[model samples]
Target: MSDFIKRARAAEQAMRSVFPATPLQRNVLLSERYDADIWLKREDLSPVRSYKIRGAFNAMRKQDGQDLFVCASAGNHAQGVAFMCKHMGVKGVIFMPVTTPQQKIQKTRMFGGDHVEIHLTGDYFDDCLGAAQDWSAEKGGYFLSPFDDMDVIEGQASIAVEIEAELGVPDHVILPVGGGGMSAGVTTWFGDRTHCLFSEPAGGACLRAALAAGHPTTLDHVDTFVDGAAVGRIGQKPFDLLRDRHLSDVLVLSEDRICATILELLNVEGIVLEPAGALAVEAVGEVQSFIRGKTVVCVTSGGNFDFERLPEVKERAQRYSGVKKYFILRLPQRPGALKEFLGILGPDDDIARFEYMKKSARNFGSVLIGIETSKPENFVRLFAHLDDAGFTYTDITNDETLAQFVI
Candidate 1:
């Protein structure tokens, strides 16, 4: 047996004391959709609603006389470490970006209780990380990296141990990569036995960037929507292990496409997957041909979704599917101008948003309109009606800059 596999098994054994292995059952909806036997390693159903707890648990357990643990995170990793601190009776200090959602902050506090102290510093995760590391050094405490540490990687490998024990081996496994800890450990365990496809958010595909550059490269910017796996760079140790991986093994998914998957899973299968948790599941569509007749497993990484973002998620999903759109319309400044424009919409079309941007214009008014309909085909008819009516309008649905300021 390989040393990494042996250690992973040991870590899996140790993890049973903290939380049971997450579900690795077949998903009927995904199975039928892809024409393959699809299984989900439901890490989203873990104790802390993420696989992060495994790394935190194993890392804490392996340490000796480490009374204090410090980490910087604004999402699942924070809660994972906090839960471990409360469980192991160790003092923990968690640093979070000031802009982190209140829901996440509250959840972390609830999990850690009095065992952990939270300090909100800086506006971004990097800023918080720097503060946490500086505090750890100054106070003589162990600084726990979300994924960079060796112990954390070993802890994450426990997932592969559980998977092999339950299913022998899967033909293909889809993994979501952030800092590469989980990908490194899981890949190390399965090695060449299983075909592993690494999934990353297209905007923050540090792993893909690293593979292209032949080394770790910091992303210029990252879209934090998939907060669970949108890392700027992969860890050095993980890169070292995954350096030999083929470029084709990595898949970049559109952030909007992921939102559509999230809505699909929720509405179709009654599964509420957070953006990051949906990463692996979302990639299945792109690789459907490859796994059409094979046994596949997609790791649902985390389900720490904030309910308040439901509107944004829904909007994104609708926009991506083309069933919803936003447009700037020029309306003649007349009493019935709004009514005339409304006649252009199909019977199934519904206006989700309507705002008059320039009502002071004497000849015409600039109107921001958001339309939702039963099907994407409805947009074709609506646009045709607008054309026939001689209405001047601009579809700003895919205009990022304009949407950012208005949507």
Candidate 2:
């Protein structure tokens, strides 16, 4: 066995002092769907509801005499560090963005109890990070990076050690890529023994961008829907470990599609997964051909989801599945105009929204319409009927800016 694997095994054994290894259970639903022996490494079931606690605990344990630790995070990492600080009886100062939800702040407080102090500083994570770094430096406190630190990477490798200890190395392992710490650690430990696949949210595919550019690169814009994994740049240390990985091994899934997967897991399997947690399981469909008949494992990274986002999740999923759409129609000013438009609808189609915009000419008015249907094919027929009737309409379901402002 290599030195890294040995260290990972040691880390895994040491982690039992804090919490037991997370479950690795065969998922019958996914196995049947993909024709593979599918298993889920349930990091979502951790005390912090994320694999982040592994890295946090490992990094903090090695600090020995360091009683003061500082870190910045708006989500899972904050909770992980807070939990560990409480467990280690160390003082921790955590900085988070001002816009962070109350539920998350409460959870971090609950985890840390009296051992951690949370400072809600700026509106963005970068701002909070800078403040945390400066504050930690001034106080002679050790700064705990969420992913870039070597100890944290090795800590994350404990996940791989746990899997290997139980299943003796599956044929393939699919991991969700955020700053790439967990994926890098797992890949380093597995090396040539297992085929590894990385899944990332399309809005923040830092790993894919880094692989393409031959180095870590910053993104101009990132959608924060997948808040846990939406990193602007891959961590320097993580990129170094993942530098040799091919672009083909990375799958960038759309945010909308990920929402669909989140809903599917919740509705079908009774699994409540955050957006990042669903990435690996969602990628299974993208590589079904290669993983077929093989033993495959997907790391479900976190379940720190708020039920308040359910409506938005459902809307995004419906839009991606083509079962829902919003459009603006040019309606004639005649008395029967609305009735004539309704006559073109299919039996399965339902009107979710109908409103007449005030911006209208004497002869014509702009009508905003939202439609929900049983199948994607329903839109084809519905649109065909609209065309036949000489109705002018603009589909705004995919119009990002316009939909954001109006829908």
Candidate 3:
């Protein structure tokens, strides 16, 4: 084993006291569907419902005499640090964006109890991070970065350690990349022994951007639907480890498509996963041909899903599948125009939403319509009918720019 892998193994041993190893189970549904032996490294099932706790625990344990630790996170990392603080009986200060979900904030508070202080600051993660860093420096406490530090990366390698011990060496491993700590740690441990595919949300492809530029670079914008993995910038330390990595090894997933994967796992495999947690699973369909008969392990990174978002997840999945669509229709002033337009819809189609935007003139009116159907092909049939009937309409379901304001 390489020196890094050896140290990672030692870190895994040390982490046993904090939390047991997350499960690595063969997913029968995925195995049969993909015609490959598929396994999931269930990091989502960890103590804090994420692999984050491993890094936090390892980093805190190595601190020489630092009584106070600080970090900023909107979700998983906050809970991880809070759990570690309570476990270590040390004081911790956690900063989160003011817009963070109430469920995550409550979970962090529950984990830390009296051992940690929670500060809701700023509107964005960067702002909270800045505040955390300034406070850490002012108080002379160690700032525990969520993914940027070497010790944190080393600690995350424990996932690879457990994977190896549980299942030997898999032919290929798929990991979700955010700021790169988990990917860096796992890939560094496997080295040349296993083929590795790194997946990231298309909206937050920081690793892909880094690989293209040959260094860490910031994304112009990030889609935070996959909150856990939506990092705007890749960490320098982790990017250094990933610099020479082949571009083909990095895969980017659409945030909407990831929702489909999350729904699939929940419905088909009875596994519940957050959007970031489903990244590796989403790549399986894209890389199916590459792993034909070989065993593949997908690291399901976290499962800290808020049930309040389930409706949104289903909506996204339906939109991506083309089973749900929004349209704007221009209705003639004639009284029977509404009836004629409704008649054009297919038998299976149902109006999910309809609202009229009145016009001052009596000659024409605009209506916003939402349609849902059992099959995506139903939309094509409905569109054909509408075209033949001469109904003026625009489909805005897949139009990101237009959907922003209307949908």
Candidate 4:
């Protein structure tokens, strides 16, 4: 074993004093569905509902006399640090974006109690991180990076140590890639013993971008839907470990599609997963052929899902599944034309939204329409009816550029 892996194993042993090992359970439902021996490394079951606590605990344990720690995160990392701060009787200062969900802020406060003080700054996480570093330097306190630090990376490698010890050796391991800390650490430990599949949210594929550039590069824009894994840039230290990796091993999943997986696990298996946590599980469908009849382990990285976002998740899932669509139709100014169009609607089709835009031509007006149906195929039938009836419309369901502005 490499020196780093050996140290990581030691760290794993030390962590048992702080918190028990996360469960690695055989998922019978997933196993039967995929025809593979599927197992879940439930990092979500951790005290902070994420694997981040491991990194925080290991790093803090090694810093013998440090009394103060600082960090910036929108959710999981912040909560993990707060929990550790309280546990270790150390003072911590946490910085988070002002737009961060209130649930996360409340949870962080609950975990840290009197040991941590949270400062909400900046509209974006990068701004908050910059502020945190400045404050740490000014206050002469230790700054705990969410991913970049070597100690944190080694701590994250503990996940691999536990998995190997619990399962012996799986044929394949799937992990969600965010800033690359967890992926780098775990992959380093496994080495060539197991095939690794790295998954990322398409909106925040920092690892993929790093692999393509041969180093870390910042993305101009990032969708923050998958808040836990939506990193705009890969961490420098973690990127060094992952720099030589093959691009083919990395898979990017659409944010909307990830919502479908979140819904699937919840409905089918009673598993509640945040968007980032579901990345590895969602990748299984993409790599089904390779995992068939093999022992496959998926690291579910977190379960910090806010129940308030459930409705939005369901909406995105339906849109991605093609069961929902939005369109702008040209309605004739004549009163009977509205009756004629309504007459062509299928029995299964339901109008979710209908609003008149404005009268463009003397004989016609624009109408925005949102339709929902039981199946994606229903849209094809509805479109045929509209075409046959001489109704002109434009489907805007898949138009990302326009949806961002209008929807």
Candidate 5:
């Protein structure tokens, strides 16, 4: 066995003292859908509701003389470090962006209890990260990187060790890429034996950028919807390990489409997967033809979803599936005009939203309308009827800038 694999096994053994191995269960629903033996590595079931705890545990345990641990994160990494600090009986100072959701902040405090101190700093994660590094350097505290550290990378490899022990090696392993610690470790441990696939949110596909540039390249913009995996740039250490891998191995999934997968898993399978957690499972659609009869494993990376976001998730899912749309309509300021517009909708269509303003001197009024239908094809029919009736409208469902202001 390679030395890396041996260390990973050791880390896995050490973790038994804390939390049990997460389940590796065959998903009959997914298996039937893909016509393949599909399994989910339930990392979402980990103590902190993420695989992040594994790296935090391993890294903290290896620091024999270290008493102070510091880290900056707006999500899972903060909770992971806080949990470990409480478990290891060490002092931890965690830095988080000031704009982080109250749910996440409360959870981190709950996990750390009195063992950890949380400092809300800056508006963005990078701002807090810089403050954390500066504090660590000044106070001589050991700074814990979310993914860039070698010890953390090795700690993350424990996931692969547990997987191999449960079912040996599968034909394919789908991993979600953020900072790349977990993917790097798992891929390294599995090595050439498994066809490893990396999944990234299309808005923050840092791994894809790195592969194209032949080095880690920071993205100009990032959509923070997939908070767990929306990294602006892949970690330098992770890129070093993943650089040799083919670009085709990386899959970029649309943010809106991922919401549909999240809703499907929630409604059909009763699985509450965060956007990042659902990436690997969503990727199955892209590779269904290739793994028809093979054994496949998808790592459900995290389940730290906030219930308040459910409405937005449903909205995005409906829009992506074409069952929902928003539009601005020009309605004549005359009697029966509103009634005439309503007549354009089909039997299966329902008005989800409607707002109108009639200018005193204008001949026409502007109407903002949102429509929901039973099927995606129903929209085509609805549009056809609108066109035939001579009603002027603009589809604003896919207009990012306009939707942000109106929707």
Candidate 6:
């Protein structure tokens, strides 16, 4: 075996001291839907609810005489480092953005207990990361990078090692990319041996951007919905390994579609997944024809979703699938006008919300309306009816700026 493979094998064996291998379960529903032998490498089932713990523990264990380890994260990586600190009885400083969800902060504290100090340092993660690095330099402490370090990459390679042991090499391995630590390790481990598909959220598709630019590039805008994988730039080290890869190998999924996948896995399979965790499974639909009659494994990266976001997820999913919409309607300032607008709805259509706006207008009043329908095609018919009834309306469902303030 090659040296990297040997090291990965050693890493997997060492990981047993911290936690067992995450499950590699064949999902019958997904398998049947895609017409392939589909398995989920359930990293979401890990002790820290992410595969990040593997890299954290491996990197921590390899080093000697380090009493204090530090890292900056706003998600699973923070929890993983905290969990490792408690497990190893070492002290750690975990820096997070001020805007991080309370649930993540609480979980990080719970995992580390008294061994870790949580610092809410900056408004954004980059600022928090800078604070952590400066403190580490001044204090002479080990700074643990979430994905940029070689040790971390090797640690993440343990997932590939476990997959080989449990199910051998699959025909295709789908991976979700954030800063690309896990993707780098898994691809390196299975180089040229298995087909690989790299997925990223469309709003935070740093890896895809990097591949396109022939190097790591910072994005102008990123959707933080899939917070775990919404990195602005791919890590330099990880990008070096992926820069030469084919452009077609990368798949970018819309943030809304990811919500739909999250909802599907939750409602259909009774499996709760965070947005980032659903990325690989969501990509399966994009590559359905390629994987038919083949063995495929998708890494479900994390399940640290805050249930509070469920309403937003469901809303986004419905909007993306055309099952719901919002519109600004101009109604005549008369009694029968309101009833006429309401009468335009089909049987399957429900008025989810309605609010009056600009009521003082002399002839016409503006109204914000939300409608939910059973089918996407239903909207086409509903709009036709509205046109025939001489109703003036503006669909604001896809207007990001307008929908943000009103919806």
TM-scores, one per candidate: 0.97, 0.97, 0.97, 0.97, 0.97, 0.98
Candidate 3 per-residue lDDT over residues 1-407, each given as its tens digit: 47787778889999887779999999988898899999999999999999999889889889977789999886889999999889888999999988777778899999999999999998666678889999999998899999999789999999999999989999999999988999999999998899999999998899999999998998988777788887888999999898989999899989889999889889877898999999999999889988989999999999988889998999999998889999998888897998998788878899998988776367888889999999999988998989888888888888899889877
Question: Residues 1-407, candidate 1, lDDT per residue (tens digit)?
Answer: 37777778888998897788898989998899889999999998998889999889878887889999999886889999999999989999999888777778899999999999999998667678889999999999999999888888989998888888899899999999988999999998898999999999987899999999999999998888887877788889899989999999899998999999998888888887889899999989889988998999899998888889888898899899999999999889879877888777788999999998986467998989999999999888899999898889999999999999998
Off by over 4 Å in 5: 357-361
RMSD of each: 1.4, 1.4, 1.3, 1.3, 1.4, 1.2
lDDT of each: 0.89, 0.91, 0.90, 0.91, 0.91, 0.91
lDDT of 2 by residue, 1-407 (tens): 37777777778889899898999999999999999999999999999999999889989989999999999886888999999998889999999888676667889999999999999997666668789999999999999988888888999999998899899999999999988899999999999899999999998899999999999998887777887887788889999988998889999999999999999999999999999999999999999988889999999999989888999999999999999999999999889988989999999999999988965788999989999999999999999999999999999999999998889
Put down candidate 5 lDDT per residue, 112-186, tens digits, no spaces. 999999999986666788899999999999999999987788888888888888899999999999989999999
Locate the minimum summed-lDDT window of 10 residues in model 4: 398-407
**What shift in Å separates residue 143 of candidate 5 from its native position after superposition?**
0.4
Ten consecutive residues with minimal summed lDDT in candidate 5? 356-365
Candidate 4 structure quality by residue, lDDT tens digits, 1-407 = 47897789899999898899999999998899899999999999999999999889888888999999999987889999999999999999999988777878999999999999999998767778899999999999999999999889999999999999989889999999888889989988988899888999998899999899988999888888888887889899999888878899898999999999999999988998999899999999988988899999999999988999999899899999999999999999997998898888789888888989899899999998988899999999899999998999999999988667655
Q: Global CA lDDT of candidate 6, please?
A: 0.91
TM-score of 4: 0.97
Clashes per candidate (backbone, < 3 Å): 0, 0, 0, 0, 0, 0
lDDT of 4 at 390: 90
